[model samples]
Target: MGRGPPVIDFSPFYGQDKAARSKLEDEIRNACLDYGFFQLRNHGIPENIQKEILRQSEDFFNLPDGVKDKYNKDVGEFNRGYERLRSQNFEKLTKGDLKEGYFLAQDLPLDDPYVQARKWAQGPNKYPSEVKDPHLWKKTVDEYHFVVSKVAKNVLSVLFDTLGGGHEFLDDFCDHPIAVLRLLHYPPQEPDASELERGIGAHTDFGAVTILLQDSTGGLQVRDRRTGDWVDVEPISDAVVVNTGNLMMCWTNDRYVSNLHRVVNKTGTERYSVPFFFDGNPDFLVKCLPSCIEKGEVAKHAPLTVSEWMKGRYADTFGGSQEKTAKEMVEV
Candidate 1:
């Protein structure tokens, strides 16, 4: 299909007529079932805050290599902290994922319950202490994280109703989620590039939902399931792109799809993006929604907790399941 993904406005949720709410729900359902993605606007994040977040990201990524490297340790098995470019390899690329990133999570302490449980990826954020402005970058990110989370919870509410569940479907897990906010920087590419060169590999997100913010220099592409072709997810001014993830597909019993996507940067300018992943509480049980299972259809997955599924997926990506590989690498 040559069509672009749908644009969904969530105004109805802010006390509108019942008819408007119904129409929005229908759009949400159709977008999820067919496109696996949608663009959102009027989601309540301030414009100034978005711009400041991007500015801080650019400032941090522009820091000298030596200064940045001091915090580049692969803590918790590469889950958070500074990761250099080309450190991660994708099977589809001759080069590795060509973007460097700083991974962050809700700032927690060593004695936090999740950390005490030995849950990997749960820790305090890695801040650049030597930077000229104290907490400038950290401030922007922390504020943006709080802002986007509100947007995600609102989206989740719509998703809950779309699956024929009530408002309480996601209420239990939204307040204390296991989410991560990643800031990515893709350098400019040569004017003439080969097919093998890629900014990021084709893969599906491992969590439940992703909300992304990027500059106008667009390079994101989504794989079309019906035609088996790639579609450009162009950057629309002031719009945040949202997509479902693998665990969400499982929860919906395959009613929704988690699309395959990749990124490439050929615009001869640095590209930056921020993607916030919304994960459920570690112990939240993710089971198929009753409405998703028809009379003859059966649930596709057994009852599984969010942390268990996420950990298993990480293991699969890191080749930790194979007997030989498992011995060589520590589990994420």
Candidate 2:
């Protein structure tokens, strides 16, 4: 395989020719099984939407620290609102990540059952008010979330099909997915920065899959499962990187890889990236697939809901103290 993640043309998946679609499916399946990461081109998201969101990201992050702090995520909030630089440390032993970010998910109304129940990561997003055009900011972010979510679901459908399961296998599971979209900005590291300092530390994603849109300033790296070497995931214009996550590995009985990845921005220029984490329905049980289990081998993990798994992961990354009840103040 090439030094970086494989690049796959995703347009054929939507085409009418079954043979072509199947060939692409094989490529996707292999990517997940081997590299656990790949880049997709012609994935259907509009170019304008992509460009607009990045523009919005830069604008929001450029605002004064005081203005951005108003929307800072609360101590207990696992997702939503802004998080300051060095607020999170993904690698337990390393320093806090040297990047700042904004988090958002489906803007559920206060009256929604999940919101009422205070489900983890189930709530409305907190948008910054200081932006030049607050309305446009919200609109662009919401539009990107809507379109990218569809792409994520399509990718999931193909993954299910590859495991001898039908496309509808994950239909209900995706209905109210625990999706979170993060807009991140990584400042240039000092020339003599400590090895422990990172834009974001080496860690596997906690969800089912991630779709990442990165700017030209690239420093992302993925660990090669075979050789245990970290390989760069360079920027590809108009293409988004996709990677498998821990939940996917559990569902497939570890047949699919969920590789470790991290970022360290040595590039002098600022780096920005948007990553959409599609973790699937909170209540959906993640159990091993029959096809994934060998003839005599049994499933490796006990069945659990998506929420349970996510809660533990958030606690691990954000610290146990940060885990608390969802906010009482709700937005429609």
Candidate 3:
């Protein structure tokens, strides 16, 4: 097994051995402080589920353009559906993304009458039934969502311990956090012209953390904070790439930086990546911890719920158009 800097086997941490857990916790802390992103191997997410997701995603994308358009997210502000190429703005805050994507959120209770009424915030996901093999696509995507959710929660446990808190600290807050998994498809382009374009532009995630599963094409790059150069993030088989987000940066009082990254269309080969984002429950209160804050140092941020903080960042990062403030969402 090829081990990168600060990459420790997480399996030992889950054991009852206090000594092993402590050692791993120290490693985890170093990972957070230094890289802000790490590659995880032997992470326990089942292989079948991962393969199935990729297989189905390929099938879904192969569908006719008209059928894929049936699930376009741009039809509404909720954007809980498919996004064709150029649907999202990712380059220079002005240009649109050159890639296509499928956006899926945690499933909610459909029977709730208010669910349908809140058209913008939460609405039913538009499953692409128009595809040739609708059943296969729907089933695979659903299975992928459940499996990734499990892996994400497990990662949260390590973060909880590393942050000097118990798993309950995160569990109590993330009953069903505003988590999302985005499946992206960036096809190979003309060599000369594509170098200037991008699959997804440079931007920092707006949530607490993101777990990414990328193919071996190696188009992902992270900005080296000290050198101002883009470092290629190579993909290893069966490994997940994890990174801290804006909320985590705030909670850590900027001790852990949310490094900027972008996807370059380097190889003349198609690339597919799945990035799972975990934003703690909206109502979960977030405040600077004693370890992160000093006696004389003023707290940079006031107490705010995870949801409120996330909603604001989402609006800025993803361009949520809702006029309501975080306070207004809480009232509803």
Which structure among the candidates has the greatest lDDT? 2
Candidate 2 lDDT by residue in tens digits, 201-229: 98888879999999999999998878878
lDDT on C-alpha atoms for all candidate structures: 0.79, 0.87, 0.71
Winner on TM-score between 1 and 2 is 2
Model 2 vs. true fold: TM:
0.94
Candidate 3 colliding pairs, count: 1
Tens-digit per-residue lDDT, 1-332, candidate 3: 12233455777755798888787778778878876777877777777777777777777777777878888877865557777876666454535666888888766666644355542234456677766677887777777777777777787778767877455576765665667778888887667764558778787777778888887788888876667677788887778888887677767777776777888776888898888888766667777666777778866666677766666655643555744344311110
TM-score of each: 0.91, 0.94, 0.87
Which residue pairs overlap in candidate 2's backbone?
A: none
Clashes of each: 0, 0, 1
Rate residue 288 of model 1 by lDDT: 80
**Model 3: clashing residue pairs?**
282-307
Tens digits of per-residue lDDT, candidate 1, 129-224, equal 766675787888888988888888888888888888676757777645788898889998777777778788777887789999988889998888
lDDT of 3: 0.71
lDDT of prediction 1: 0.79
Residue 75 in candidate 3, Cα distance off native in Å: 3.3
